[model samples]
Target: MKTFLFRSMIGIFFGAFLAVAITNCAVYFGGQELLDGETFLKNSLGSIFCGWFFTVSPLYFELKNLRLSQQTALHFMTVTILYFSLSFWIGWIPLHLKSILFFSGMFLTTYAIIWLSFYFYFKNIAKKLNQDLENI
Candidate 1:
């Protein structure tokens, strides 16, 4: 129970961090377009929610005995790619994919960034926990 709670909290923190990362990236790259407060807020919140959803697969993999790296990566890619397509197609935020292949490429790139960010965030926490356990 405790391990589950701890890992879940770490996952949630990673989700939040991923959100910030996306928001910061947008601000850096799309400053002019996001000048409006409403657009900025929408993008910020959207990134956070999507980050949370993406983080779930990793957390599940951690909880389960998922050993196949290739399978895990493929599964994550499939889910995230579909999420991007659905979000764009539903008029949720107007992704403007332009092309199916192009959208998939962009989705994979974004997923890689978020996944790496979450990986480091969770690793730091796990290291801290392990050190504390060793001390005790």
Candidate 2:
């Protein structure tokens, strides 16, 4: 529980940071004024909520009962849908076919990247642990 809270705090910090960074980059590059303070606050809070929800949702599931492939597929689909809906609702993404497709592609790419990175990291840790056990 303490670990979960710690991770949630980190996730919210990064999520808010990413949200601001991306918005700042887009507005700066486009030569547009920043969003009004209230709007920016809303967006930032939305991002924080999204991050919290994402972490909590996965914890509610019993992924250990599923195979690795199943877990990956479930995580991919759930996260993609959850993010799409949240983004669209919060006006980060537009509600149109092209926007949906583009967002989906981007989400899928990032999801795969993060998932594969963790997959390899944990696999390496397990391998090292096995070697140590053998030495013992």
Query: For candidate 2, what is the lDDT?
Result: 0.78
Model 1, 133: alpha-carbon shift in Å?
Answer: 22
* lDDT per model vs. reference: 0.65, 0.78
- In model 2, where do residues sit more than 4 Å from their true spots? 20-34, 54-66
Candidate 1 structure quality by residue, lDDT tens digits, 82-121: 5765467444535554565676678679867977886789
Which prediction has the highest lDDT against the true structure?
2
Total backbone collisions for each predicted model: 0, 0
Clashing pairs for model 1 are: none
RMSD of 2: 3.1
- TM-score attained by model 2: 0.73
